[model samples]
Target: MSRVLVTGAASGLGEALAAAFEARGDEVLRTDVSYEGGVETGASAPSSTHGTFRLDITSDDDWAAALAHVEATWGGLDVLVNNAGVAGGGRLDVATMDEWQWITEINLFGAVRGTRTFVPMLKRQRSGRIVNTASLAGLVHPAGMASYNASKAAVVALTETTGHELAAYGVTAHVVCPSYFRTNLTSSMRGADTELAGVVSHLVESSPISAADIAAAVLEGLDRGDELIVPDQPARDAHGLKQSDRATYDLVMRAQAAKLEGAPRG
Candidate 1:
């Protein structure tokens, strides 16, 4: 069985992916900033094949420690899933500098650090996979989430570049662009203002996909060796919108915004 390490394993997609891997008899190491909480609750009922490690993705020292633990236990990692992220909800005009920095630190820089620190381990394996969780917001920018969109878009670019660089080493990279998966990521999102909060709440309510579905899609993508994994129907459509026509895509997004604003609230 393959050995895997997943970041942001406290909840949502990361937790789901870790559970899936463990269920398949793979050795899974789950990590998150929520050390006590995640260990006590996140993997409360995890399979026998799974273990937990407290990791702060933004810290190099934490990554080093986690890698050392993997070396001691699993010997080598076959998969590295950078699933940690923070959502920043706000309009471009009013977004704070601190919010922008914080979002990028976790969402973009965190992935970069994971990829960098784990590549040596993966290179030793010769045949390994790296999955970075991006989002549909990366492809089709929504009106009020500029910082989040930018960070995810950077993840897409980073994944593409890293995939090319690691190709010669027999390591593959995949970027998951999921649309509106049901998870705590939304509830924990930082809002710029009250107006942005309302807009974000509406978006979350309208999302049709779930974290479990996205996790399943990730495994399928890994099996297929897909470079970019758009997990759901909405994600597929959003990707198509990017490639079809720029003007048409903008018009469609504008229409969506209008409809969201007009829709009744409970």
Candidate 2:
């Protein structure tokens, strides 16, 4: 069985992913930034997990401690799932620089810190997998989501580079670009006062799929050895449209942008 580590596991997709892996008999280290003070860093509490630790992805010390725990406890890790992120976006003219930094730090740099911390051990072992959770926004950029789009897109690029860079060491890297599904991700949404944020929240809340469904699809994708896994039909269709019919894609995107422009700002 694989020894897996998942960040942002307190709830939502990360929680579902940890459970999915554990259900398959893999030992999982479930972690979240919110799980602090009550549980010591690297210490497992009696939650629904093989182990649960408090890991603030923004902190390098947390990353170092996680690496140490894996080394001392599991000997090494087989899969590192960088799934921690926040939801935030606005128009280029509307989003503040600070808001962009906040989302980027957690959404993009969090994955980077996790990957950077674990690569040495994975390289030493000569076998490992890196799974990064991006978003459909990364692949198909919609209007008024420049910050979120850029962050997730960067994750896709990072995963691609990591895959190519570590291929010789038998390490595989994958990036999950899932469309919106029913999850608590919107709870962490920043700039809730904005119209764009409201639209994103509506889409997420109204999705037919659940976090478990996406988690299952992700596991299936991993089993199939997919490098870029777009786990939902709508996402696949959107991306396919973008590739096969750029003019149509442009029209659709521009239409959405036009709608956004016409709407009253919250």
Candidate 3:
């Protein structure tokens, strides 16, 4: 079985992914920020996970420890899933610098840190995969998701560049962009806009799909060797538009935003 490490594995999307990997018989290391309450685990967390460790994704020292642990236990890692993220609602005009930094530190830099940590091992193996979780907002740019959108968009770019750079080493990198799905990120989001929070929460809760579904899509994407994995249908459509049509895509999104109650008008 391949050795796999999944960040943010205590709950929600990360937990779902960890469970899926475990079920597939891979040796899984589930990592997350150790909360005062406990390590977050989803209802479907698998009993077969190899181990769980405390990992603050934004900290370089924590990532070093995680890699060291992997080296001690498994000798090498076959898959690294950079799935940890935090959402922050933003009204750009009024958003503070600290708000941007908070979101960027975890959402974008967290993935970059994970990728950088694992690349050496992956390159040595000459056969491994890296999956970075992004979002549909990265592609479509929803009105109120300024910080989140920017971070995820950066993840997309980072993953793509890694994929290209690692091609010669036979190590593949992928970015997963999923649309609205139930995730703990909603509860953990930081922002002052209650209305933005309410809207985001509504969209998340209203999603017919669960984190498990997104995990399944991710596995499928891995099997297919897709570099850019758009897990949900909405994300797939949005990504398709970005890939196929630029002008019409932005125009449509802007039109939709025009109807938003609090959105800025043209």
lDDT of each: 0.82, 0.91, 0.84
Off by over 4 Å in 3: 35-46, 244-247, 261-266
Question: For all candidates, what are the clash counts?
Answer: 0, 0, 1
CA-only RMSD, every prediction:
3.3, 2.0, 3.3
Model 3 earns a TM-score of 0.91
Write the residue-wise lDDT of candidate 1 on 1-266 in tens digits. Answer: 88889999879999899888877788787888887433333446355356677889899999888878878777888999999998775665567899899999999999999998989988877878899999988788977677899999999999999999999889989999988767888677774555666666676677787787889888988889999999899789878977988889889878866764554332
In model 1, how large is the Cα lDDT of residue 30? 84
Off by over 4 Å in 2: 37-49
Candidate 2 per-residue lDDT, tens place, 70-188, comes to 88888999999999999998888778899899999999999999999999999999999999999999999999889999999999999999999999999999999999999999899
* TM-score of each model, in listed order: 0.90, 0.96, 0.91
| Candidate 3 residue lDDT tens string, 12-128 | 999899889888899888888863322333433346367677899999998998889898888899999999998886666656789899999999999999999989998998989
Candidate achieving the largest TM-score: 2
Cand. 2 Cα-lDDT: 0.91
Error of 1 at 132 (Å): 0.2
